[model samples]
Target: MVPALDSWQFWAVLSAVFAALTAIFAKVGLENVNSDFATLIRTVVILLVLGAIVAATGQAQALGSISGRTYAFLVLSGLATGASWLCYFRALKLGNAAQVAPVDKLSVVLVAVFGAVFLGERLGPANWLGVALIAVGAVLVAQRM
Candidate 1:
């Protein structure tokens, strides 16, 4: 049986696929451009695509209904995303995508910890173990690959 599209695992796998493509595409694109400019172009594309999505879905009007706190958090998240993209592109420009991508994935472990601490999303032993394994795997993947 096929997994449901709404399942979190399904979405997670989709996200991973796109992320892999992102690394490959960004690496190739960075060869002849400044990382900052590359990031700007990418961000503009994202804005256009997401804007179109929002408009097509009739969610454009929902923006006004969002709370100020939500706006603050989203803006902060956007800034973090921009910073991450800049650093990631710079790293891809300087290092192997194989090495840089895995190291960049260290954010998974950080996310788990932050979620538990800040969001009170408790993780069981299995989840913590998974996070540990990801951290170790990231280190291993970063080694002279």
Candidate 2:
């Protein structure tokens, strides 16, 4: 019998491909569309597609397992995602890819620090070092622009 791939592994692969396509497409597409509008359209399409999948898969029970607090957190996450995407797409439209990409990627470090501070997630020494490097790189990219 074939084994199923882990969910994180599947998403990791999918996200890598999607991220590459997003960068390329955002660069090209923004030439024609307003960047903030483009981000909204993309997010709306994504939510619709994923929502339909959840409905079609009879996953309402899975969603029901989430508590009110978790639901609130998820909604808040979606809101923040929308805001961030709008900013990133605007940057991509107005700035060079080299600088915009690195500065946008700094969200990784921001999220890690937020998780450690608010979500009770622990960042070990190595993770701290990585975050430091990311910060330095982001600062250099922005400064050089």
Candidate 3:
């Protein structure tokens, strides 16, 4: 059996747990702070923690060793992440965390579509059905009664 620590499914589940906690914590944290400022603070904390982890793990690499294409893609991804955080924070500030988080999770659907189109990833019919169900579920969860 694969070790739980080394399993992608295990990490993904942890990520989801942490993400859920982030929404709840962020909602509380945003009570008095500006959403953009809250996001900035969160980003700084993330950078510091990740930097420490990389240093402790000896995973730091020389910037020159990375390819220009990699740098470009990483920059684009950073910008996208910043934009997403800003939008998510704003939504959380204006809406219930329960509602905001489900709508934000629509990113999973987008990722599947974008992966297929841009990364040449393929999904079978069952996978597509699951994606469709996720979209519907997100919409349903985000609805206010």
Candidate 4:
């Protein structure tokens, strides 16, 4: 039986699947277009899709109720996402997606560390082990071949 969809792990795995596809698709698309222009197109598509969802669900109506702190952090997150996309696309344009994607996954390691320090999230031995494996695997995948 499938796990409940509400679980974060399930969602994270789904995200990983899509992220892997994103690299493959972006690599294919980048072959013919300027990476920056491609990024703009992708961003526009995402905005349209998500805007439609928000509108359809009446979620947009709640926008005014968002707290200032939440809004600030979300804005910051959006900026960070944009910057990451820009850099990721540029890197994908120049290198193999397989190599680039693993290197990008290093962000997972950074997140673990940052979450501990900034978010006060506790990371036990298993979490640290997983982080280490990710770091080593990223290096292995990103090696010159």
**RMSD for each model, in Å, please?**
1.9, 2.7, 1.3, 1.7
Order the candidate numbers by TM-score, best to worst.
Answer: 3, 4, 1, 2
Model 1 Cα lDDT, one tens digit per residue, 4-43: 7769998899999999999999999999999999999999
Return the clash pairs for model 1, or none: none
Stretches of candidate 1 exceeding 4 Å from the true structure? 1-3
Residue-wise lDDT of candidate 2 within 1-145, one digit each (tens)?
Answer: 2343656777778986888678788898899999988987888899899989988987767667789999998999988888888888999999876678878888889889899899999989999999999989887977754
Query: Deviation in angstroms for 140 in model 4?
Result: 0.8
Across 1-145, the per-residue lDDT of candidate 3 in tens digits comes to 6699889999999999999999999999999999999999999999999999999999999999999999999999999999999999999999999999999999999999999999999999999999999999999999995
lDDT of 4 at 41: 98
Of 1 and 3, the candidate ahead on TM-score is: 3
TM-score of 3: 0.97
lDDT against the true structure, each candidate: 0.94, 0.85, 0.98, 0.96
lDDT of 4 by residue, 37-131 (tens): 99999999999999999989887756678899999999999999999999999999999998999999999999999999999999999989999
Higher-ranked by TM-score: 2 or 3: 3
Residue-level lDDT for 23 in candidate 3 = 100
> Which scores better on lDDT, 2 or 4?
4
Query: Which structure is stronger by lDDT: 1 or 2?
Result: 1
Maximum-lDDT candidate: 3
In model 2, the worst 10-residue window by lDDT is 1-10
